[model samples]
Target: MSAHRMSDPLDRRRFLTAAALRGATVVGTGVIGATALGAVDADAVFAAPLRRPLDPAVPAGAFVEGRITSIDGGVLEVAGSHGDYARVRVTGATSVWKVRPTTAASIETGDGLYARGVPMPDGTVAADAVWVNIVNLHTTIRGIEKTRLHLAHGSHEIVGNLLPATSSASYSGAAPTADLSGLRIGQGAQVLGAWRPSDDSVDIVRVAVGPGAGHRR
Candidate 1:
């Protein structure tokens, strides 16, 4: 059966609209805060930090992470990381963010995605928000300087730059602190940052350093 036909038209629209609005509000607040913190370039702060992974035991609606295989109309066919398949339906109200808040048109096939939305009975996820190509990396700090950290994520060496006013660090989930002086060379850290569109570098948003730090999303 078609996923779109499973719900009452009005009710489905209302649900999706509410979900999208909520997602937009969340992203909008982050962007405003980043801007206030000297992130003058919209693209630099578009991908806000995702502090932790969603709990698998929680009953929160659907959260899908994967690479997009195809786009047909407003629907995206995704090949999930865990070998599952998902059909994500995007709508006019869907909040899509790449490096910054953008329209759904900015999404492309082969892009990696993380989507939050309501799962429909017919197995399609009605997406409220989608983040494209955002990367959360756990690595060891090989070296550090006043403005950059040289990191080793597996075999890849990543250069992460600290945004002066927006970059922050947290210890063991405590409140984030602007002072990054506590970071040490060879420490394990997790970086919540945006991957450069065509490069291996990242623009650091928040760094979490402590025990068990090399956790993947």
Candidate 2:
């Protein structure tokens, strides 16, 4: 985000509001996890499959994806699947998201990491953003039974398990709510949560339904 973008809060609010409205009718990928602040970013994350492509002005080496094998001080040793490796350094300014906005202390070894940052002189990635164990996807509500939501992701139907203790829903860019009465069958939604590799299911943390999804009083 540039300074001009942050100069006015309304800019983001308005943009997100429009984004929410646009997302309401569209199903997209989810990046799981709920934020007390809300779902505007959740809606914007995948506003469109390729709405705003990555900015080329940013340096090329600003991304690092791998598994955390070790944490020494503020740095994490990452091993990529393709025989690649990297050293990621987390700083105070770094925004860490592990189920929620957290700190480096919450990060653990063996957790997956996808970082966006600058390259340091020491060949380390000076991370500005870090997400641990996060999965973002677009899904449509197929069915809902109790705490479970059957979602259709592309051609596959996967169950979205809502964790009552931590799961939340964001409506029309509003703050997160424990009440999930907003979710309706056949509605498109964005989900941010953890992916259960064991069963190919998802443990939903935060769900974002666009403006047309309706508002609950």
Candidate 3:
């Protein structure tokens, strides 16, 4: 069976149930961050706020953000962060990454998402890429060890794990290097990583140190 079809049916069902409940609550309560976009302009919407502009060769599309409301087959229904609703069509060509290359089966309801895709005439988005539950956090290092860094993000404590062969650190915003020995306790850092669905832990993709640590794209 294809990996996409490998998600446990029971898990999907449970996720769908929870998603429905959450969607209703979100709608009724009128959450603070939810806003509706009457019309979407993909290129303008998906552009990363802090990152460098994407290549001009890329086609324009709507950028959608919010919690997953439902997933039926390959269509993902999302309640936009600003109160808009969007249907994102995911195909085999779509690149799904969350700190690393991943499959569509890994997606679950209630998870946050950022998707970039061409907007269809029908108002749906033909997604070319999706980043699920990715977080860029600016925090201070509370403690450090050989393989993990204890961080303070507001009032919450975050545990960041350095993934061997994949994790690296950057001084300023220069090229990333594998050496993390320069990282120190009580230092300010910015972490770009994927949040674990089960806990406050994050699997680090890259760590930035120094005054401009967390501001880089």
Candidate 4:
């Protein structure tokens, strides 16, 4: 028989089982954030610099805000602080963000807003955002719903809300409708766009998921 003979099946099985157990243990011990897709360290995933405070000197093209009464047909129903309400369409470029529970509680119907973005013909505001939350913690996600994805990263988790893959949202290839059936759950993602300051949620602009990622428990 050759020196390089086939390995023992029982040994290999044992080794693999041991490795899997170790991995699970590490994840359970809070070294990694677990999701339906995969695990990432909390320090690495939720780690983002705080958004700068709003400046009065800046122009109106910098930000916008409104209450989210409806999210139907890829459109957002927002009533402005100045008593103006409009339905904004989310095209192939909108990005969605989800925030924490404490952050979501501060906001109520009919609040003042200041946003920055290119204006649409119908008086709807579009652009990225910067604002203050009820708490001092740095935020990443904006508005999370049932199908929204969350990956545990240590004690914390990486969260992502669904949105229309629009030009403004930074998606180019295919558009995932607001319902987000096509997008895989529990994947590594980067959410970009306007955030609701008072509520601590985001109106997403772009979402980037990792390669070959899947969901986990």
Candidate 5:
């Protein structure tokens, strides 16, 4: 999930307290992993989806899908399926959440998201955001590493250890690779994914990061 009132620490705390009363858990315990720090300019990877109206009568209103390119404070930088950027505002009323059954628990970069709300003056959509739309894509593993792994579609740079049961399970038609040696650093990969915000790391079900991973989903 996300801390919506991210602009001010004090405001975040107060807002979170209110959210807790509303039955939303606001602890920075689990859900978000990574710092949202690194530059994500990899625009060539995603393919644009065909546009179908959410409701023809609604004209300017429809659901758009995209990969989360970056998150700075309360701002969510989403590069759309068509390679367009949708800068969304994560306000106190905004929700931070996830999709289910992808993993035990893990959140990482590259998750899919959908937001709903009004568009703002700066070209950013003001999300009356729903956090549950975020999805953890599942893929098979083709490589491994000491810290990071070469997944099947995108790189899963893990920040912690992988369990034997989790690592050994077959996903996307392949079992987990045992050794980390000889894996390329910049190749793309895919894997069964999960997000555990408490640990600040994502768990991989499988990975396919390598030279042959250009197959798009």
Candidate 6:
């Protein structure tokens, strides 16, 4: 067999480094601070330390924040909430999270996403990390059941599904734990998790109650 040509178009090494760097999130820190991508050096931005403080900056450039409209192999067509569109290319090195750390195969059309990566010459974003159906909401627990929690966010009520093995809690600035005993009804909390499109419910990653709830980082 002939020797393979060393002319692969994509630089996998650099992309790997970016993925490794961006994957760092402090334990129990669910919120992400996305700064403007235009002025940032693409090489360093992915390696940049994610600040703990919460800032709602929408990462521009090759970053896509929206719902997946279509999937063609590893390519995802996304429709942004704001009248924008993006095409994201997922690869083996891409880190995916849907409720938990998962793989690209778990992504489906209609799943909401936030993908950040470098832009190829063809205008497709080569994703480093993709978070599917992820939502971080600040709500007050109105009611609690064995498997679900009724939450009130402003005037909208939401049903938060609790997974016995997956759902967790962080109480009063403590680290995350599987215990739900401390959660009190009517307590203000932050729910971070994946949204279930079929039922409009959330499979919670964890419910945070304490001095560190909400967008307090």
Model 4 per-residue lDDT tens digits across residues 129-199? 21222112222333336545443334665443344443122223344334443344454445544444444
lDDT by residue for model 6 over 1-217, one digit each (tens)?
A: 0122134333333543343345422222222222222222333434542222121232233578999999876678999999999988775456577887655667888999998776655677767677899999999999999999999989999999999799999988789999998899989999999999988999989999986335464
Ranking by TM-score: 6, 3, 2, 1, 5, 4
lDDT of 3 by residue, 1-217 (tens): 2333344222221222233323322221222112231222333323322221143332354688988889876678999988999987665434466677666777788778888765655566766567888999998999888888899999999999989988899987778999998888888899999888677698899999875534645
Maximum-lDDT candidate = 6
| Candidate 1 per-residue C-alpha lDDT over 13-54 given as tens digits, one digit per residue, 9 for 90 to 100 | 344544433433322223322211232333432332222223
The number of the candidate with the highest TM-score is: 6
Distance (Å) between predicted and true CA of 134, model 3?
Answer: 1.3
Name the TM-score of candidate 5.
0.33
Using all chains and alpha carbons, the TM-scores for the candidates as numbered come to: 0.56, 0.58, 0.65, 0.26, 0.33, 0.72
Please give the CA lDDT of all the candidate structures.
0.68, 0.66, 0.67, 0.36, 0.43, 0.71
Count of clashing residue pairs in every prediction: 0, 11, 7, 40, 33, 0
Candidate 6, after superposition: displacement of residue 176 in Å?
0.9
Please report, as a residue range, the 10-residue window in candidate 5 with the lowest summed lDDT: 40-49
The reply for model 6, stretches above 4 Å from the true place, is 1-13, 16-61, 211-217
RMSD of each: 10.4, 12.0, 14.0, 24.1, 14.0, 11.9
Tell me the lDDT of model 6 at 168. 96
State residue 20's C-alpha deviation in candidate 1, in Å.
10
Tens digits of per-residue lDDT, candidate 5, 1-217, equal: 1333233223322332243234333223333211123221212101212122333332233244676677655556778888787865554434444533221133234656676644444566644333433334534344456655534434443442354544433323454565334335454344444555456455544444444645543
Regions more than 4 Å wrong, model 2: 1-61, 81-83, 171-176, 196-201, 210-217
